[model samples]
Target: MARRMVIIGGGAAGIGAAGAAKAAAPSAEVIVYTAFEDVGYSPCGIPYVHGKEIPDFTSLFLAEKQAYADAGIDVRYETTVLGFDPESRTVQVEGEGPSGYDALIIATGFDYKPPGVPGEDLGGLYYVKNIRRAMEWDKILDNVRHAVVVEASPLGLEMVTALAHRGIDTHVIDPHPWALGELCDPDIVAPVQESWAEMGVTTHWDTRLLGFTGDREGHVRTVATTDGELPAELVVVATHKVANNALAVAAGLRTGSTGGLVVDDHMRTSAPHVWAAGDVCEIPHGVGGLPLQGLTGSHAYAQGKVAGTNAAGGERAYQPVYVPWGMVAGTWMIGGAALGEVAATALGVPHVVGKATGISRARYFPGVRPVTVKLLAEPRTLRLIGAQMVGGEGIKERADFLALAVRKGITLHDLASMENVYSPPIGALNEPIVTAAQAGVST
Candidate 1:
């Protein structure tokens, strides 16, 4: 008899696992259970849908129902897996009905936590994490003239940008001194702040949202921050994310110190014949193997592949999870190691870095905007450790090269001597990567 492989959560990781498992064991039965109505929609595109960047909400679907069926993988939508039994190797799924599985893969992903401040449960308050929430907010956009966004992380910034594009009076409030505090340093952050300001997005820095005020109808009217109160027709809380690991915990699987399911290199959880992926799994830190770092789609997809392959009687080892390099808004692109302050301080690298705010292509190039690049290296070791870049165009690709350099432990001298294709219309004679490395070496 063919083995039965059950995968939970139809996000990036779950879908990838289902596909890989079917390929590895052609005779095996692969079934994916998703709580959402849609199976393979892109979570990252939620902001774009809100901004109308995507023409329609359905455009974010990565795969259609027929696509999964074509692969011979059974997809059960609107089915929530409540818990699992390790001894029986079965999962308790709720929605249409309860079901059982021989082997299970958990990839439930994460959810945003609205700030616990008063009036948070008001009608106008929102947090966009999935397609349903995005669609709901899309309708609310027509009624909202002003919106206040709490938190300025990537998701928060994206939502604020989308609101501003819709001509809504948008304000972003964050306790951090600058936006993307975890990704970029102060030098790189300044240009992004300036860009947001130029776009007419008001910012409240170094302040916390204390509470909210409501109108006579009990709808949120204004946001009360530590600084003051601001009028808002809608309030969005985008503070932080928590993994959906209740099923894994209920199955008697070991959880990480930070609350995610603890999995080994093979994506195997503490329970036998069970695995976890995506946001529910606490992947190892690239630098120090630390736990609790955020999980991205790329990491989830890779982990799922490993879990699926191994579950089909194949041997595969997943590599260490690293920080992702990708684009966000059209103008601003960030790429770097998402290292903790603890790691930075432990390295104790006294490196001198130079930054330049210039055009992406050339000053004469059309549609070019100001791009900033910051490089970090240890002068004594000459090893390039970190770099951050932000710009309107061509910054993301360049940052990828820098991230590669850091991952390979490339020295400043090596990067200085590296060759790069360049043209006045396309790129600089000395690329930002080379220039930044040379600057680090000189210092």
Candidate 2:
């Protein structure tokens, strides 16, 4: 009998795992089980489609079912895996009988974090976790006049902008002191916050949702927030997500402290012939090897490759995660990597901060954009631990450089001394990083 590989979930991670496993072991039969209808589509683009940035909902889909078939992979849609038998190396599906596999991969993804309050099950309550749920928003947005989003992450801001663009009188309620509180520092987010009113969005900071009231039809009508009641026709819970570890936990696999599957560096679970990856995973971060979740498609895809390769009788180690994430909010861009001051402090590290503000291009250049750079360092060793940037067109490349620097433990002075290119039409004469590092050195 040929080797058989079964993968759970059909998101980016599962799809990548299917393809990689097939490629690594050509003779093996690869099967992917997904509860969702679509696979390999970008979840990050869900907001853009809702905001009408994209033409239609179908545009977000990556490929059709035939595409997977052509690649010699079987994708089972709307199929739920109920149980796993480690001794038999098989999985129990909803309708189908036990499917034997030589190896199993669990890329079960994540579920939306819901507000712990009553009436959340009401008709108007929605969530923006995956593209499938986002599609429902486009269909139902026509009837919504007032929409309230609960949370203040990048996705929350994006949903706020989308609802505002639709003239829905959007209001955002966040427990954080400021907007995009997790990604950018308050100083970097000030200008963006000030522009909320102009964009027709209301900002409610340091506020929590108490509960919700529904009409006779059980549709959310009034939102009960800490400050006061707001008339709301629609409510979106655009908050963080927890791992989708139902199948993993049921299979008696070990879980991490962070509530993700405890996988080895190669993405192997404790169960025999089983591997796990994607948003359902906890990965190593920094030199400390601390387990953290970097909820980006890039991270999922990379981890899936390792899981698939190893499941197919190949050896591949997962690299230490230097997660680089960013978002474009209105006209401003925010990005970060590794340990920020908040994370470092929680980790009990003695840390210092460095900050610099400059223009993206030469002072005299046309279309010069404002840039802010902040670096976090270990005071004793002077090692760059984290970098955050809020600025214009050029912030991403600079953030990427700093991410690598943090990964390699480069010192602030070393970065300042490194050679950089500058041009009148291209970039600033003095790199923003040099100034930020110089600021770090001064501390």
Instruction: For residue 23, give model 1's deviation from the true position in Å.
Output: 1.3
lDDT tens digits by residue: candidate 1, 1-443: 88999998898889988988888898889999887887777878888878878888888888779998999999998876777788977677764354566678888887776588888778888877668877877998988888999998778878887887788888999998887665556666666677678778999999998999898899999999988999998987887778877777776789888788888888898888888888887876555566754567777888889988887777888866446455564247655553423246555635656455556676676876666666666658777666677777776676667666667887888977889876667775657667767776776
* Cα deviation of 309, candidate 1, in Å: 1.7
**Which residue pairs in candidate 2 collide?**
none
How well is each residue in 1-443 modelled by candidate 2, as lDDT tens digits? 77899999888889889888988898889999888777888878877777778878777778877989999998888888898888889889998788788999999988877788988889888776567777777888988889899998777877887787777888999998998666567887776666668888888999999999999988899999998998898988887778888878887898887789988889998887999999998988864788876378888988899999999998888878767777767567777777666667767878888889988889998889888888888888889888888887676787778878988889988977888779878788888888888999998
Q: What lDDT would candidate 2 get against the real structure?
A: 0.83
Clashes of 2: 0
Clashes of each: 0, 0
Indicate the worst ten consecutive residues by lDDT in candidate 2: 286-295
Q: Per-residue lDDT for 239 in model 2?
A: 77
Q: Per-candidate RMSD vs. true structure?
A: 2.4, 1.7
